[model samples]
Target: MSNPGEIAAVIRAVLEALPVDALRAANTAAGESAERIAAATEGTGHDAPREALAHIAEGIERTGEALAGLGEIRERLNAYLAVLVPGVEAMVARPIAGPAGKRPITPPNRRHHLNSVGRKSQVREENTVILPGTDVRGDLDAIRRGEAAWLPDRDRCLVNGRLYGVEVPGTVYPDEGPGLVKLNRSEYKALKGLIEARGDMDSLPSALANNPAVTGADWQRAAEVYEHHKDYRSEDT
Candidate 1:
């Protein structure tokens, strides 16, 4: 047992030598920092959920941009079609007229098909000629005399193995077909009866109108018949 004054002095010296005050101040600062950290964490919440929301907003904006681009492209295509439609309609509105019963002339690219059919055989073998009607008897006699004339009114004629050409009743080229054949006596009589009934020699001929002569007739004899007939012969002849 020491004196009370001396004991108190020793205890004070021990407390000063130790770091107790420094430790207390450090603990108080640590508690304040922890509380600040807790408040900051509560205020902001989880970073992951906010990041997910930001990504969703960005994706929606990109999708909207893509849809707008598509709409612009569609508008451009519609404008192109609107300009093109009227020109196409105008072309369709106008059409070219061709011959009534004849084939459209062969195009250049497909003309090779005609080579096998039109063999360029003898004119007699390729009897593709169609002679003038009886109204033009003088023209027929001139052809028999070895003259080549372009007779527009009739199918072209083959005279002395030569083609006398025409346009309306087109001249058949050597490769086209065999020429006309002779009409039998009975066929000739029937043809004459048709012509007599119509009495319009310049109009469609008996063969073309409605007669057996249409298939194949002796156009040479047919011409002669029209020439001799007083009712059918031209006034000039």
Candidate 2:
């Protein structure tokens, strides 16, 4: 009968203790390698230092991808725990005192690292079906069907829509697109919330762009309007 928040705390603790520690070590190693390469190239005009830097960059990228995959697993585990644990709903519904509830129990640094990984995953997934001059309709259909094998030229698509050229060739679909294509559960939830607020998926991005508070404000307004109309109907009755 663990509370939802308690389950979330446990998940965060488990992730922070192991995966986050490993990720930090990887990041530190990558940083040290980059710094060493930069120092070696301080005076020399040789391409060796540049090549070393490139290798460091690749290692860092790989570490980031690994972290993202781990984070997705952590999230899935947390969701499962919430479903299995009794009294979780009641605990989550009860508000805590002070900023304890406002601030997530998960460490900010760890959360930021996880978010970075999730964002990278999204960019990779979106680019798979969103190449330059791609048949938008067909691509959308492929995405809907969750077909990973249909995409080609995995290296050419934009990363974060900024024209990145780094491409590691192979079957980009790792573990049924876990590391590269599948949307993290939180991402799926956010997308669903946005669509519900905006009336549809097509309108979501625009609504978000035009008003960052679109979902919160619209939901609150909807509740208020419903209550007002309900009161009027009650008076009439």
Best of the candidates, TM-score: 2
TM-score of 2: 0.32
Q: Residue 9 lDDT in model 1?
A: 48
In Å, residue 219's CA in model 2 sits off its true spot by 52
Put down candidate 2 lDDT per residue, 74-140, tens digits, no spaces.
Answer: 6676567557674443122222111222332221122112122322333222221111222333322
For all the candidates, what are their Cα RMSDs to the real structure?
46.2, 21.9
Model 1: lowest-lDDT 10 consecutive positions: 89-98
Clashing pairs in 2: none
lDDT accuracy of residue 81 in candidate 1: 39
TM-score of each: 0.18, 0.32
**After TM-score superposition, what is the CA distance of residue 55 in candidate 1 from its true location, in Å?**
0.7
What lDDT would candidate 2 get against the real structure? Answer: 0.37
Model 1 regions lying over 4 Å from their true place: 1-44, 87-237
**Which tens-of-lDDT digit does each residue in 1-237 have in candidate 1?**
456545544443443443323322332333334334544666577875445544533443343334334344444534443454423221111111112114322211211121111223222212222223221233233332222222233334322223233335432232121232234544354344435443354565435456553344544455544443434546575
